[model samples]
Each structure stands twice: as structure tokens, then as C-alpha cells.
Target: MFLLSTILYDKNHVLQNNILTTLRHVLSNITMAKNEKHSVKLRIWFYSGENKVLGKGRIELLERIKETGSISSAAKGMKMSYRQAWQMVEEMNEFSKLPLVEKQLGGKSGGGTKVTEAGERAIIAFHTLENKVNAFTVKEAEKLKF
Candidate 1:
């Protein structure tokens, strides 16, 4: 009777271990599937010769400037320095056919910045291109292997 009880205990312990192992495998696979389903994102930047024409970052900066009406404010919103923001605005204006950002000096109404018609068009075009590229990459990502 003692021997029989010991054998039964060993069998039960073995079954429990096997069940735990299977559960772990199932849970791991579930986690892996969740990770695998994550979507892919794409960013694009346009350039002419060696200078960056427009991209997500610059477009966003332009949008921010439009919203705040000040290069300094926009830089603050984006956590960038005023000088850096000024440099980017200068670069964009220099690279494009038309000046994208217009600055007004301090006066009765104080100073501010404005996005020109051409700048607005640039933002729209960049976003449109970004959307198309993102769609293409997402579709392509579905076929990629680990």
C-alpha cells in the first residue's frame, strides 16, 4: 500500500509539471502573436542635392509655427532652441522657390511669424506623400519574415 501511494504521488507530480510547461508555451505564443501584430510606421524626407527640402519634422515645425505664430513659441512647443528653429526656417526658405516662413519684427502688435501659401502647400504635399508611403510600407510589412 505504501509503494502504491508513492507511485500515485509521483504520477500526479509529473502530470502537474507537464501541464505547467504546456501553459507556459501557450502563453509565450500568445505574447509572440501580440508582438507580431504591431503595425509598422514610415517616415519620409525630401531632399534637393544635399539639402533637406521637407520631411515630417520640418512639416511639423511649420505646423507648429502656424499654430503659435512665433518661431520662438514653435521651438518651445517642439522642445527646440530658437536658433535651431530659425536655422531650419532659413534653410527651408533658402531651398524652396518661395520663402516658407515670414517673420515680422516687434511693433505695435509685437513680432510674429507666418506660413506662406507656398509653405501651406508644402505641408499638404508632404503629408500626402507620407500617407501614400506609409500605406505601401504597411502592406509590404505584412509579407516580411522575422
Candidate 2:
């Protein structure tokens, strides 16, 4: 998607130096998986000991839980099974200092899942940073493509 958009940006942000030229060369190689029907982009990657992260699946999942007020409902909203959603939340809990989703015990209406304030903050920060970095990457790639 970004690659496709870049063909039209060169005239808008062209840089003309070896540093910028080298930067462009590097950016041209960046790639992302995108859906044609919805213009959604997916990024997947692994991290080493320092624990860098990639992709937005977990964050989005948490947002859904917050929106629907239940893990099962969130999973359904995301088109994933309940088991899958639970596993994701579990894995995130194991790795992070903060737990992303919180669950309530049963009452008259039964129990439900909710995003903690921390979780909501994480969602907002993760998405905001992702948009910025992905845009930077795209622009850098544009420099390289020529």
C-alpha cells in the first residue's frame, strides 16, 4: 500500500544528496502485507532479548475487548475464536510488566473482560506510534526506490 502510494510522492518530497539517496535506497526494500478489500496493513516480526515488538494484533484485540466489554465478544468482533483471544491475552500478560486486559468475576450479569486503563493507554500509544513509524518507513523507502 505504501509502496503504491510512493510512486506519486517523489515529486512532493524529493531529496538530492548522498545521505538522502542512501536513505531512499534502504527504504525501497521495506514491505508490508496489506488487504486489498479494506486497506488494512499487517506487520509481523519477532524480537530478541531486548524484546522489540512488531505487528498490531494484540493491541487491536485489546481494543475490541474494551469496546465489547467481554473477551468472547471481542474475539467474535475480531473474527477469532475465544480460545485464540484468550491465548493472546495470556501471552501478552506473561511478557509485559503490565497486563493488558482485566477480567471481572461473575455477578448477576456474569463475568466479562475489560481493558485496564493501562491497556487502553497501551492501545492508544501503540497505534499512534505505529502510524508514525510506518509513515517514516514509507517515506524513507521512497527515498531509496529511485
Candidate 3:
């Protein structure tokens, strides 16, 4: 009788362990499947004929310049050097139909930078287009199977 009971207890223990292991495996697979879902991503840039003009980084830099009123301050905020920021501004000015930024001469207060009307329009246009593209991509992402 004791032997029969011991044999039954061992078999029950093994069966429980097997069930638990199988449950763990299934749960892990479900979690992995959830995490492995496909998504879409994109980057956008404006060009002047064959020359690349503006993109995310330049737009952000323009925004920073607009906010701070100083190119050096904007560069510092972006963790970039002043020279690099200046070069970007120069490139943008060259590519744009109107100069995107202008320098104000020093006076009683101090010299500063400012974004022109065109720069503001460019910023708004880029954000609007980016939002539209993002919305389209999100809607399309729903159709993905794998």
C-alpha cells in the first residue's frame, strides 16, 4: 500500500511539473509574439533640385534658433558646436528661396539672431507634412500581417 502511494505521488509530481513547464513555454511564446510585431518608420528631407536642403535636424535647429534668439545658444542646446550650427544655417540660407535666418548687429543691448518669415513657414510646413505622413503610415501599419 505504501509503495503504491509513493509511486502515485511521484507520478503526480512529475505531471504537475510538466504542466507548469508547458504553461511557461506557451506564455513566453505569447509574450514574444506580442513584442515581435512589425512597425513602420520613415525619414523625410526637402531638396533643391539635386541638393538636399532640410530635414529633421535642420528643422529642430531652426526651431531652437527661433526660441533662443542666439545661434550659439541654440547650438549649445543641441549639443553641437557653434561653427557646425553656423554652417548649417549658411547651407539652409543658400538652399532656401528666402534667407531662413538673419543676424542682428550689436547695439546697446546685444547682437542676436532671428528666424525670418520664410523660416517660420518652413517649420510649420515641415511639421504639417510630417504629421500627415505619420498618420498615413500608422493607418497602413495596421494592415501588416507579419
Candidate 4:
């Protein structure tokens, strides 16, 4: 579980009398060590890079290409340019050190792309495990109030 910290203020029941009373209490307890309010929220983005991202988009593209008949068709279905999807595929292939897709050249059957065995492995690992991790993190976050 991740321990995230954030600044918090209690203004829900604020009133003039409450403010004065709080100030008096603080002044009376001046010698006591006060727990300072957090002044900033610290949020960590796990993947902060092109290569670092788990390439779920590339996985979906590969899956779609495998299901459909063409890379162009998959890109269109994903609402992405073929060139952009191709670039993402290249990046993921490099990041994973595995060729996640293969191409068949022109013929009467037509040229198209398919996910390799390694690609299938990657898609399963990414979607299943990453989803579990995210769900756990979300549940943990929901458990925290202040």
C-alpha cells in the first residue's frame, strides 16, 4: 500500500467564537509541541515516461489487429492514426525486449498484423495484474479520510 500525505484544513464548523477559543487554546498550549498541518499533497505518478508506461494502448491495438484483419482497421477502431499506433507498438516492443506483433506481407490474402505468442503473454500480464494492482490501490485510498 502507498502512504500518501496531504494538507488538510478544518473549516466546516468555523465561527468567530470558535476561532477565538481555538486561538486561546493554542496560546495556552504554546509550550506544547503542536502537530503541524500538512501544507502540500504528495501524489506519485508511477509511470512518468513514454517507455515506462505499460502500453495498454499498444496491447489493445495488437489485440484488435489480431481480432480484425488489418492494422489500419485496428488503428481506425482505436481512433488513432496508423502511424501513431505503429509508433506505440514499436516503443512497447523495445521496452519489453520482445516482438509483440508480426506482419504478413502482400498476397491475395492481403498484408496484415498479428500478435505473437510473446504479445499474448504481455497483454495478459499487463491487463490482469495491472488492473488488480490499481483496484487494490483505489480501495486503500478509499480507506483513508485525513
Q: What is the lDDT of candidate 3?
A: 0.86
Q: Which ten residues in a row have the lowest lDDT in candidate 4?
A: 1-10
Taking the tens digit of each residue's C-alpha lDDT, what string does model 2 give over 75-135? 9988999998888877776666676677887974799988787777777777787778788
Q: How close is candidate 2 to the true structure, as a TM-score?
A: 0.62
TM-scores of the candidates in the order shown: 0.69, 0.62, 0.71, 0.59
Q: Judged by lDDT against the true structure, how good is candidate 1?
A: 0.84
lDDT of 3 by residue, 11-97 (tens): 556756655666777788888866775778998998888776789999999999999998889999999999999899889889888
> What are the per-model C-alpha RMSD values against the true structure?
10.4, 15.1, 11.0, 13.7
Q: Give candidate 3 regions above 4 Å deviation.
A: 1-34, 105-110
Worst 10 residues of 3 by lDDT: 1-10
Best by lDDT: 3
Each prediction's total of clashing residue pairs, residues at least 3 apart in sequence or on different chains, is 0, 4, 0, 0
Off by over 4 Å in 2: 1-54
**3 against 4, candidate with superior TM-score:** 3
lDDT of each: 0.84, 0.69, 0.86, 0.67
